[model samples]
Target: MLHPILPLILFAFVATATPGIATTLSTASGAQFGFRRSVPLMIGSAAGLATVTGAAAAGLAGLLLAMPSLQLAMKIAGSLYLLWLALKIGRAGPPNLDVTMAKPNSFFGGAGIQWMNPKGWAMGLGAAASFAALADGPGQLALLLGSTFGLTAAVSLSLWCVAGMVLARLLKTEWQWRALNIVLALVLAASIIPMWRTV
Candidate 1:
């Protein structure tokens, strides 16, 4: 029981810390708008992940899994949204850097991405399932999982954003900036494919 509980925390940390859609968005936002402006994105993403964890403990993740069609629909929807975001990120750079021209990714946008992603759903469900420490109470499970993921997500995403900020300093020209954005956008788009490959 102790082993299971301890491992779950490590799982949550590593899973959230791994670069994914949310972190990609954070990186792009940090590069484009700097850390202060990217704070909302970080917070929103963490909130969104917390929601997913709580809902999984609440049983919505089981409902999604029981209905394959609904799950597929969600995956498709999330992928489409990410693709659209990738396009927007790719197109935005120094020429499009005017804050008025292209505002940073918003709080809601970050949350929405988490809500829609299959990877998030999968992680939530996995964490919520049959853990010994949480055997006596679902509420306890949700609280623990949500809090763990949320904290890990915030720290992980902020690091990625900081990495993006650091990368920004290396860009000596508009073209370099644009190229970096394009590369990030491409990686973000590519990230979606792995979740579906197993399906």
Candidate 2:
């Protein structure tokens, strides 16, 4: 049982660390706003991941997957939000590197992204499905999966943030800043494809 569960933890780490909507957003946020302002986003993303994992353990994933309309709605809403965020990132100007002039991505915004994110759903569902048999009870299984996901997500997201912060130093001029923003925006836009396919 422990052996099997250990692999799931590794899976969570790999999944969260992989380039996806959440990681892309975290990187962009860290680059634009720095580490301090991005803390809430990281925390919120972890919380949201835990919530999704719990929901999956409780069998909500199947219900959501079965309902095509609900899945479609989520995909549309998530994609639109990502596009809006991309627009904001693209238009942003270089601010005082120490003091962010633009509003940073908030806790709710981070959580909301997970709520609508299809990859998040898939991860939760996969975790729950994979680990359900190891626990003594459904509640225990849910708690275990949720905690595993939450911790991995927090760590992985923070790593991405740190990467962005390091890269932020490269934007010496306004044009460099703009160019980085455009690239981030393009990456965000490209993420929509996976979301669309997941639904």
Candidate 3:
């Protein structure tokens, strides 16, 4: 049973670390506002993922699966939100050299993204489903899964933010910042492919 969970932990790490809307936004925030300002968003993302994990362990995924229409509605709503985020990222201006002037991604925005993120739902549900039988009770299973997800999400988001900070130094000019923002926005938009397939 422990052995099975080891693999799941690894999967969680990879899934969280991979570039997604959350990571992209974290990176963007870090580039624009630096690490300190991005902490709230990172914490919010972890909290949001923890909530998803808890929901999955409590059988919310099963409920969603049973109601195909509801699931479809959620997917559509999530996709639209992602597109809107992409648009915002695309239009974002160059980073303000003065930290005081920088407008970073907010805690609520980060949490809201995870709440409506289809990938987050899939990952949480998949993890819970894969590990359900290993635990003795729903509560125990939820605690384990939620802790694992929250830890991984926090670490992964921080790494992405650090990477963005590094990249921020390289983007010395407005054009470079604008170009990178566009690329990140495109990546965010492309992330909708998985959700579209489910639709």
Candidate 4:
């Protein structure tokens, strides 16, 4: 049996390190909306991840993983969506940089994105299987997976927020921030190609 804690640790590290749409959006939100507004978005992202991982633990992910064509289709669609997001982010105008103008909808929006995210589903399924296989009991496995995912979300979102804050601090002008956003967007878009190939 695999060590339950081991899988949890793996999942946490993997989720935290992976730079996905959620991370980019969260960073943007933190930079544009401030930490308070970004919190909701972070919560939403976490919720979505938990939903998918829980589904994987329930074995739904197996059905998806079983079909190569379906998996391929999902990968393509996810990659395309990510590219679109990157483009949109790149083209967006600079924000007013006022926290009071911050839109909280971004948090829930990110959460919704996680549900349809191929990367998220793949990670969730892998973690679920790994945990289920090594767990001595269902309860222990659940606990481990939950804790891992929760911690991953917290750490990942915080890092994104910090990145945004750092950028905001460094770039004082609207044009500078706009330019940075474009770079961020392009970097995100470029990552999709490699990830798609790997998938």
Candidate 5:
């Protein structure tokens, strides 16, 4: 039997290193909202990653995959949500002056992106399935897989956000920030293709 913990470790490191829509959005969040404001988005992303990983480990993702109509539902919901977010971000008038006092963008921005991100689903499901296949025992494996993936996602995504924050200084203007957000939103919207194709 495979060393039970190795798969979790591999999943954590690999998932964190792989750039996904959440990474892009987190980077954008850090740039636009600063590291503090980006917290909500990051948290959201981590939650989404955990949810998917848990679902997969528990066999829910496989069931969802087997059900054609359910898969279609998820695709449609995710695609439309992305489109809505794109429109909202594009129309955002200006950054509030009291941004520092405002709530972090980590919650919705981070989490919402993960829910709509097909790549996230793929990673979570793939990792969980591989772990399940390798495991010799069944006790609490799902919990272990979920926790490992979730913690890794949070840490990994935070790094991306911080990198974005560090790079924000290079932008040097409000227009650049706005333009970046628009572009990121558009990218997020465009990422729905793989999910659509699968459906």
Candidate 6:
């Protein structure tokens, strides 16, 4: 079956291009650890989002949506985790913000976060609902969603990471670095509001 590949690519691009929890994490990791060390974060983010989108395509999202209590619990848990991350990121410095800190936001961290990310859920559910029908079967739909979103996410997040790396070079002072961290943390924390309001 011809899988509307072009339209799927376009849709995936738009969804992944928008800044969200994953992008924010990518940018933060890049700024803190530089592009090379942060590669895992970007890759894991792409993979995690792909998994989420694929699972949603496989009917997990629908099951969650039908369970109001479970969904609310997930939202609360996700919000708390994001807030904790924001607090930690907000407290940045010179020596303290080294590549060693990368452990917290390594590949596993990036992938784990997406499971609780509202933006990931939004995009995954949206894509599953919008594009799943075009697929020939559940397995094919999951594969299509995963592959398309994964590739687009990789590119989009790499750009975000690069942007953060560039911005880091411009920072001459500790205060400037701290300020950027604070701003990123705030934006990441703030990302929850819009999605929370809808729920």
- Highest-TM-score candidate: 2
Error of 4 at 185 (Å): 1.1
Better of 3 and 5 by lDDT: 3
lDDT of each: 0.82, 0.85, 0.81, 0.70, 0.68, 0.80
Query: What digit string (tens of lDDT, one per residue) describes model 3 on residues 1-199?
Result: 4786888789889989988778988888888788999999999988888888878887777777788888777778888877887787777767764333246767877887777765677777788778888679888888888888989999999999999899999888888888888898899899888765652
lDDT of model 4 at residue 60? Answer: 66
TM-score preference between candidates 3 and 5, better one: 3
> Comparing 5 and 6 by lDDT, which wins?
6
Clashes of 4: 2
- Model 4: residue 151 alpha-carbon error in angstroms: 3.2
Q: In candidate 5, how many Å is residue 109 off?
A: 5.7
Would you estimate the TM-scores of all the predictions? 0.90, 0.93, 0.89, 0.78, 0.79, 0.90
Across 81-126, the per-residue lDDT of candidate 5 in tens digits comes to 7676666555442355324324445475566666655556666677
Off by over 4 Å in 2: 1-4, 97-101
4 or 5, greater by TM-score = 5
Candidate 6 positional error at 182, Å: 1.0
The clash count for each model shown is 0, 0, 0, 2, 10, 0
Tell me each candidate's RMSD, in Å, in order. 2.4, 2.1, 2.6, 3.8, 3.6, 2.3
lDDT (Cα, tens digit) per residue for candidate 4, span 1-199: 4553664676576775577677777787777767887888788888777776666666667787678788687677767777776766676655675333335445556666666666666776677666676556655555556556866887788788888888878887878977987887887787666545545
Q: Write the per-residue lDDT of candidate 1 for residues 7-82, one digit (tens) a residue.
A: 7777877898787888899888888888998998899999999999878876788888889898788889989989
> Candidate 5: misplaced stretches above 4 Å?
1-4, 91-109, 116-118, 133-139
Question: For candidate 2, what's the RMSD?
Answer: 2.1
Per-residue lDDT, model 2, residue 193, is: 94
Cα lDDT over the full model 2: 0.85
Which portions of model 4 miss their true places by more than 4 Å? 1-7, 68-73, 97-105, 133-143
| TM-score for predicted model 6 compared with the true structure | 0.90
lDDT of 2 by residue, 79-124 (tens): 9999998888887767564233377888988888898887788878
lDDT of each residue in 35-103, candidate 6, tens digit only: 888888888888998998888888788777788787777778888888888887788664355432444
